[model samples]
Target: MLIIEGAGRWTTPTDGANDWVEHLRMPDLSVGTYCIPAGGLDDQSPHTEDEIYVVTAGQARIVTPDGATEVGPGSVIFVPAGEEHRFDEVTEDLALLVIFGPAYGSRAPAHPAPLRPRS
Candidate 1:
């Protein structure tokens, strides 16, 4: 078993314009804590893994291929693989917990039919 205290983690710099800290990343999952300063924006990027973001504090707008959505404290957002997305216009210092990784057998089956190649 692993225990992680968010407050104890060290912040790491990412290319994105926000303060980020890698909290925990086990064999089956990865987690991070992020603080987006007011008016800050995280440059858009795509991911190979699925991800979920839980807003712990502040507010921001998430831009995705589908459209833009408002997220704030208590808001939860899921981002699918290969999605183009980013955060923008953070009203206050935004804090969030992000999780993503290979699904442990405990949760669900890991493999499904392959997706068609992107056009």
Candidate 2:
């Protein structure tokens, strides 16, 4: 069994380094935790793989082609493959469980994942 003690340690105090902590890695999926500082900016651009964001703490606004939505603890957000998105208006340090299907750095499929958001 894989256990990552304290996901908060995932963030790096050092600059110019990846701060995400990957708790699991597989051929078709990966799970990780990331923390953005209060008032931090998300410089990330559109990605090739669909992603699901589970907000574990803090608050922010997520913007995409579909427009923006305020998100906070317990919020779940989805972004389609190749669709532009980013975080803004952060009021607190944001902690998230980020699931990247097929994982980043691995080859991505041409289509979005077949699964839909759970009701």
Candidate 3:
């Protein structure tokens, strides 16, 4: 059995430092906490694996190639593999639970499939 304590896993971003703190890692998936202070920048690039983000606190707007969406606590969002996305305009201290399928950085560096336009 695997157990993760959320209280111990939570972390805040320091100046010029990464905001993600991974907690669990398995062959099928990986979990982590991502926190960004108000007005902080999310300088992450597209991932090779599909990702889901569950907003646990604060407010922000996620921008993608397709469009943008406002998010707040309890909001859940999904980003397909190789799609460009990032969070911006954080009005408050944003915290989220991030889940990656097939484990983060576990895939080969080969070219990923292009993202289809959402209907």
Q: Candidate 3's residue-wise lDDT over 69-104, tens digit each?
A: 999988999999999999999988888899999899
Worst 10 residues of 1 by lDDT: 7-16
Rank list by lDDT: 3, 2, 1
Model 2 segments more than 4 A misplaced: 7-18, 108-119
* Candidate 3: regions farther than 4 A off: 7-10, 16-18, 110-119
lDDT winner: 3
Give per-residue lDDT, candidate 1, residue 4: 69
Clashing pairs in 1: none
Backbone clashes (count) for model 1: 0
Candidate 1: tens digits of C-alpha lDDT, residues 66-117: 9998998889999887789888878777788888775312244369798899
Model 3 residue 54 CA deviation in Å: 0.2
* Candidate 1 segments whose C-alpha is farther than 4 A from its true place: 7-17, 103-119
lDDT for each residue of candidate 2 in 1-119, tens digit (9 for 90 to 100):
76766653335434633357777778888788877777778888777777888998888999988889999988988887788998888787788888888786466446776998889
